[model samples]
Target: MRDFSQDIDWLSINTATIRKQHGQEVALNTLLDQCASAGIRAVSPWRDQVAAVGLNSIAAQIRAHGMALSGYCRGGFFPAADAAGLRAALDDNRRAIDEAKILDAPCLVMVVGALPGALDGQAHYHDIARARQEVLDGLAASLEYAREVGMPLAIEPLHPMQAADRACINTLEHALDMCDALDPDATGALGVALDVYHVWWDPKLQQQIVRAGAKRLLAYHVCDWLTPTRDLLLDRGMMGDGVVELKKIRQWVEAAGFRGYSEVEIFSERNWWQCSGEQTLQVCKQRHQTVV
Candidate 1:
């Protein structure tokens, strides 16, 4: 594994990690400036955040800062209630691919949706198998466009807890299965974005990481899983603050030939979000060096 102790050359901050400061949304431009000031060479900003600030302007700012994107925030959520909804999802993803290309991101991370309207407290369908199938079809369609545009798609498998509303693909194995079915050649066009917060508890994590190898492992996200958790979606712990075996997993990832940024992607609603962006970023840097 590469040593992060000396410098943060390989560290990338996902904007969501510090998107909120003192429980308020910080502008993407301000966040970019803060990242550059902190000597963070890269970031992964969400589509909505980028859209809120305007795409071309943000691209210019990123260039001025000389920053790189580890991956794009997302381009999935393919499952929907109807045919038109599915098509809209595909259209949205195509736009996301274009945005990712504009930002020069390495890959567009995917959080494939599940159970349609489940997130809104009323599921349109309860058939998970149907959702998984829709995800596969949607991904296959999206992959065609991604290939045409020369942008890689990294499917981020949410933890199983998120399967009902966020992502139907809940395991690294399942993500890779889709990759194999779609890309088949490990061509780097289709892959997986492995997030420690989501996959740390899996018993087959190391084995699956090995199975993913380097080609399929397009991006890696780091954050701890809080014990006695409060919110499933927002209560992610900072590195070393929880029980994830950070180094060991990195070792496995590196051994399998993944040499990418260790992107810090925390969604701490009550803790880190309550702090200033500067403090949250400083802690991210420190924890990344010492523990991660």
Candidate 2:
């Protein structure tokens, strides 16, 4: 494993980690400048953020800072209420791919949606299997365009606790299975964005990482999971503050040939978000060196 303790050259901050700092939504350009000033060599910006600050402008800013994107923050949400909705989702994903191309992102990260309206307090359907099937179909269609554009798609399997709304594909194994089924040849265009906060609890995580190897492991996200969790969606811990074995998991990922950024992607509304973005990033840098 690479020695992060000495220098965090591979550290990348997923802008979401510090999006809401000091209880406010920090602007994308501001966040970008902060990340560069903090010596972060890479970032993963959400699509909405890029849209807010025009794609061309953000692309220019990223180039000015000489920073690279670990991955683009999102292009999946395939399951929908109807055919029209599914088509709409695919269209949006294509636009996302174009934007990712503009930003020169390494891959477009996917957060496959489940149950359509589940996140909004109600679900369009209760069948998890159907949602998974929809995701497979969606990826199949999107992968074709993604390949033509030479853009890679990285599916991010959210924690099972978020299965109802965030993502139906919750296991690394399941993500890879879909990858193999859709891409078949282990092409670089399809893979998974392995987030530790989601899969750290899986007993088979190490084995699954090995199975993914380098081709299927398109991106690697890092964040600790808090105990006595209050909000399942917003309560995330910074590294070392939670129970996740950060170093151990990184060892497994690296052993499997994943040589990429350890992108910090936390969604801590009550904790880190309440602090200054600078402070949160400083902690991210410190913990990344010592624990992650």
Candidate 3:
């Protein structure tokens, strides 16, 4: 593995890690400025953050500061209730690919949707196998367009708790299985975004990392899982503060021929978000070196 203990040069901040402070949302432009001022060279931002501030302007800011995007946070929600909904989802994903190209992101990360309306408390379908198949159909269609656009699609397999709402493919093995089937030739057009927070608890973790190798491992995300995780949606621990075995996971990732930034992607509403962005980022650097 790379010697992160020496420096945090490869530490990229997923902007959501510090987008909220004291329970209030921070503006995207200000967030960019904060990252720049701290000498942080890269970030990954959500589509909503870009839309809230206007894409062209943020694109300008990224160029102005010579900043880089590790990946784009999110371009999927493929499973829908009907044909019209599915078509709309595909159309939106096309737009997201355009946005990722605009921002010069390395890959467009996808949190493939599940159970239709599960996030809104009512699941249109409770059959996870059906949801999984739909995700495949959606991805196959999206991958064709993504290849034409020259943007790699990174499937982010969310935590199993979110299998009903965020992502149906909840393991690196499962994500890689999907990739292998969709892009049988391993064409580099599709892959998985491996987040330690999501896959750390799996028994097959290291084996799957080895299976992903380099081509299928598109992006890497870092965040600790708190012992008593309060909220499944937001309560995330900073590196070194929890029992994720972060360094061990990094070792597996590196052994698989992957080399990239370990982008910190914490969403700690009850803890870190109560602090200033500067402090949060400073801690991110410290943790990236020592723990991750």
What does candidate 2's lDDT look like per residue over 1-292, in tens digits?
9989887799999999999988999899999999988999999999999899889999999999999999999999999999999999999999999999999999999999999999898999999999999999999999999999999999998899999999999999999999989988998999999999999999999999999999989999988878878898899999998899999999999999999999999999999999998899899999989999
Report the Cα RMSD per candidate. 0.6, 0.8, 0.8
TM-score of 3: 0.99
Candidate 1 — worst ten consecutive residues by lDDT sum? Answer: 223-232
Looking at candidate 3, what is the lDDT of residue 218? 86
* Candidate 2 vs. true structure, TM-score: 0.99
Q: Give the CA lDDT, 0 to 100, for residue 97 in model 3.
A: 96
- Candidate 1, lDDT over the whole model: 0.95
Best by TM-score: 1
| Each model's lDDT | 0.95, 0.93, 0.92
Q: Tell me which of candidates 1 and 2 scores higher on lDDT.
A: 1
Flag the better candidate by TM-score, 1 or 2: 1
Report the Cα lDDT for candidate 3: 0.92
lDDT (Cα, tens digit) per residue for candidate 1, span 16-90: 999999999999999999999999999999999999999999999999999999999899999999999999999
